[model samples]
Target: MSSFAGVSVLDDGMLCPSTMTFVSTSSDCGYHLLVVKGYARTKETPNGQSILSHDFGVGGYRWSIKYYPNGIISDRADVVSLYVHRLDDDDGKHVEAKFSFSFVDEVEWQNPVYIRGMKTCSFSSDASSWGFYKFMKIDALERLMNLDKDDCFTIRCDIMVCNAENDAGGTQVLLPDIHRNLNNLLHNKVGADVTFEVGSDIFSAHRCVLAAQSKVFMAQLFGPMKEGSASLDVIQIKDMEATTFKALLSFIYTDSFPDMKEDEMSQATEEEAVKYEMWRQWLQNLLVAADRYDVQRLKYICEKELCKNMCVSSVASMLVLAEQHHCHRLKEACLKFIQVQSPSCLQTIIASKGWQHIIATYPSVLNELIAKVIASNQQLVLK
Candidate 1:
């Protein structure tokens, strides 16, 4: 039960006498009363103001005031309260109560304590009362206050949608393309251990990788998850040398690669073209690692380089290699390159001991090569 006093109401042309009080019967704030004063607003404000102002409850509430024929005004009967009243029919028969009273005052506060390091703040419609809601932690308090603040500061409260911006910390989360569908994954392990910290402090809690088949190099930016398991799209890197792996890890922690200069790419005796080839091989190893980790951009770099060094000899070997590793796209690309450059190229390579191994492994492919070779030689016969 709850109760309050100092409420006032007004009556007709003449001031009436009536008083009402608040009484809480149930678990919640129940009813209120108003004490009516005989006269309401008669002439106007004592200062001869055009419009009269009543300072009571804040905005979003009803105001009840009444005026009598005589110059006298009743402040009691003019009171209005939102609390409901439940009186028996026999208790009162339209008692001509003219005035009523109800008092409403806003409680002001200085600076509220701010709660720092809040990871999340949530709310429910029927979970708590207004008083309880007002006294939540500063993070929650801030969330509620955000309701009154500018749109920019308001913490979006949708349960399904996460905040669009990254956290203030170094955490970078790559979200799935189907953000709506993947919302449920937040509760999963793949979601929990995800976090990012720049120097020492964590800036973000999750950085999601969207594409399942894209190549990624987590070691290049923000070291590996260290504790959780992850999936990758492709695996190009075979066994990285101990030093190379360390270099890659360092790059991940700090966005800087080691001093891999052009001069260092080859020995002095090797041809300049061979030097480029060495660099290309080194890059291919890096691409393998990147592709295995689902880093799409890195995979593209590897493909670009391979295309630049395109040749009939390498295409057949690349096709066999790509197929062996289940690199469907890469295999198709290499096969297409062979078909376009020289259709008989694979048959010629197959006769060599080095490539005969592949032809034996794929006898059906050998038949396809023989047909292509015969077709190519048909032009020679016509000449």
Candidate 2:
């Protein structure tokens, strides 16, 4: 035993905010006009004289307002009176709601900082209306809402209908669909601030979204050189093809490759075989473009597709691509293909001379691969 007894210690008794748990509420705002066709009838109307607004719905309930011209009571005649009437079922069921009314001028401000009295009201069959007797002074209302000059003024009512309380598990919500919305934005070009010119093809995009996705784009669009392309003029991209850039944009907006139905070479005829070979070349060009733009995912995708389409003729070029684009796995795959071939088989492949393009472009890479082939053959003889 310790010498401490069952004594409670308070760490400097204090009050602070705790996690919030409360009932949810659904709310909507509806605007209705309080206009005067002429100054005469507006002022001449007797006290308690009211005009009704067309019905508007809020939170599944129909509501309309009763606007009293000279106030509902005699003593309050100098002010305008407004009452919101519920036109829903008159059954014993009651609705617990709170609402606020403000002039249109206040609601349309940069920051609507209007205030209203507190307290939620219960509306039942017997009590179906709630209101303010002194909604506003007639003279002040006219000045704020431009009633005297505009010939009409509007009032806004914001209603909050309380929802049922959630259990401890809380409420389930819908999944966020950011990709679909971003794709829509790309097609719509509603707030596009930048335009790209690839050869003769023009494309518009938002700079912020591009910056968020690619550091290369961020540097060109917002970094030190941004001053040159600051205006609406098109920024030229000379090296990339229009099709490749289009696919890049699709990935940027949707984080996915545009759906492509790749031809399977093993099952394809001679015509499809030609298309399959063309696809392999496209992947090479696309990989180079992705690397230039620093789009790592697209670059990796290109590398993987090239590896899947690799053949004896593509060995030399694939080896060069592997080194140039940081494709270590692809390099290993290419080396493995070389290591499994017999010395005579390699001679026949070299005789075919299908790798001449890579040999002309990257002679050293082919030479190194040839050396690896000789080393693997010598080891096979020793085995």
Candidate 3:
């Protein structure tokens, strides 16, 4: 009597049978495939929340619900399933079909009459029209197939739903406003304000602050305190000189990316300049600060500038900064500059005691250059 049943025809001489061809009503549901992978955790919670981490790139509609629906299970199963539902329209309009898995080892149900090949509607009126057609003994199958025990019980179904679409663009749905989660971490500190002898080296202090969020803002407050009359108010450092202070504040707020100008080294005494040996120390400090914050793009920008203005004396300072901060790319650039131009400017670096550090840091390149120098000792050496 149902539409799925056969229709009979009576002829004058004999009886004949006819039936409706499967119209694929399932495709209308928009479910392409469903994969259910199961796993056990220590208690109930797990990290990474991934059951099948090894098998990546297999994607479907993924959602993490606390418990299985239908009130069938008591505790969290740690069973995650991906439902590949087709995009379909219901009531002559677009809608998404909801599909879930029923984890069972047996292919057929007895007494209740759940069985493979039986139209799912006939066996269980409560269930959907499509049901299981195959039995995969996952645990037993794992041994037979020689798979890891941890990877055993995974079941997949090629789903057929009505009104499903073919193309589904993948996108990651990021959780909103996650930065607010670290607000307490940035503001909370437990220790007393002990007097610490701060160094003039910006890069050194930048490293300490980067290790903890609480110290970052605190370190910014004390920047001008070392210069006695330069600052008076504890809180007024925020409104200090627009140019130099903004560059310093840039490092505090985002780490690195200080504005470099011609006047950056004008105030330094002649003796201290010789010790640091470069007027570009502030720029070098910015590179270090950028590295601490993992601001890689800013770090590259500073390095590019240093390489563009490469000089024998400046190259040594950059090499030291690169080595101290593990900036391998910058260190390589410094070595290449020395190899290319140091033949003519070799005495400039040697006079400044820069060659010793270069030789110590990059022994192989130093050896090759030294040999080249000896080979042309008559012409190049002016001892």
Candidate 4:
């Protein structure tokens, strides 16, 4: 009988589905909580002594959570006891139900460590209280109090009373897709107060969004070194291409990249290869732009993609790019690729078109490569 709670802004400001994050039960299900004040003092009560909780209502029946700070049994004296008490008279009507007893922290993320009552247990005249004799160890309870200065603790009970009418099916509720809002903002150009001129193409973007995602944008758009403080002016980007910038904006808004049709590599058409190379170059440029902007996640995505595309033909040039961009992981990968055989594989890589550029521009990288080769031989010798 429960309905969708719609979307809600979390404490961290991200929009999320209320059903999963806010509520975990239907209308038929209900909750009961027991807050024991001066919880540490309860240890003096000794074994077999218990403290009954205040009454709570669920499924038209009066119920109370039972707590034993110093356990209800002799052998289990070191642990606390907990139970659900059926308070109403044993009417034999609507007495079947399921319940969970869980200890939660202040920030109530779902704890997997909870005791769920057997599904549909009958609350008959034979039993008024049914629960765990040893719910939580006293040491665990002490650790809970150490998290905060408070002398209090709480145990929650979630109850779902069974019904014949509810046996048909559960209600269908749609979860909130939060990214759709950002997608709409991006494509619809709502509140986009900044423009970028990249070569022949112009893009509309939000300054705040960009600043939040990239440190370069933060400095240039809102802080010192601002380029286009006046919203009417276009910020000139001399280096990045339009396609690369577009993909970058996509990632900033939706945290997802535009789909690159990499599967088309099998087709091997002139047009397809051209298209693929066009995107490949864009991806490479995207990494450089990401690095410049100080967008770590985007830079990581670019690095991972480049690594997946790495081959003998491109590893040498990739090594040079990695060194220039300060991409340590990519440099390591390329070094490993060439470290196979210095005379054969290394020479083959050295004969590639990019090696001449590397020799002329980055002589230090050549030294590092030789050092890596020596280290590899040393490791082999040691083994």
The number of the candidate with the highest lDDT is 4
Candidate 4 Cα outliers beyond 4 Å, as residue runs: 1-177, 227-232, 266-276, 341-345
Provide the overall lDDT of each model, using Cα atoms, as 2-decimal numbers: 0.35, 0.64, 0.37, 0.67
Candidate 3 displacement at residue 348 in angstroms = 1.9
Indicate which candidate wins on TM-score: 4
How many pairs of residues collide in model 1?
71
**Candidate 3: minimum summed lDDT over ten consecutive residues — where?**
115-124
lDDT of 1 by residue, 239-259 (tens): 564444433333333223334
Q: Rank candidates by lDDT, best first.
A: 4, 2, 3, 1
Tens-digit per-residue lDDT, 220-335, candidate 3: 43444234444322223222233343344344433323433333333357865554334366567666655654555556666755654557767776776777777776776776
lDDT (Cα, 0-100) at 31 in candidate 4 = 75
Deviating ranges (above 4 Å) for candidate 2:
1-173, 228-232, 263-266, 342-371, 374-383
Rate residue 223 of model 1 by lDDT: 45
Better candidate number, 3 or 4, judged by lDDT: 4
Candidate 2 backbone clash number: 0
lDDT of 3: 0.37
lDDT of candidate 4 at residue 271, scale 0 to 100: 86
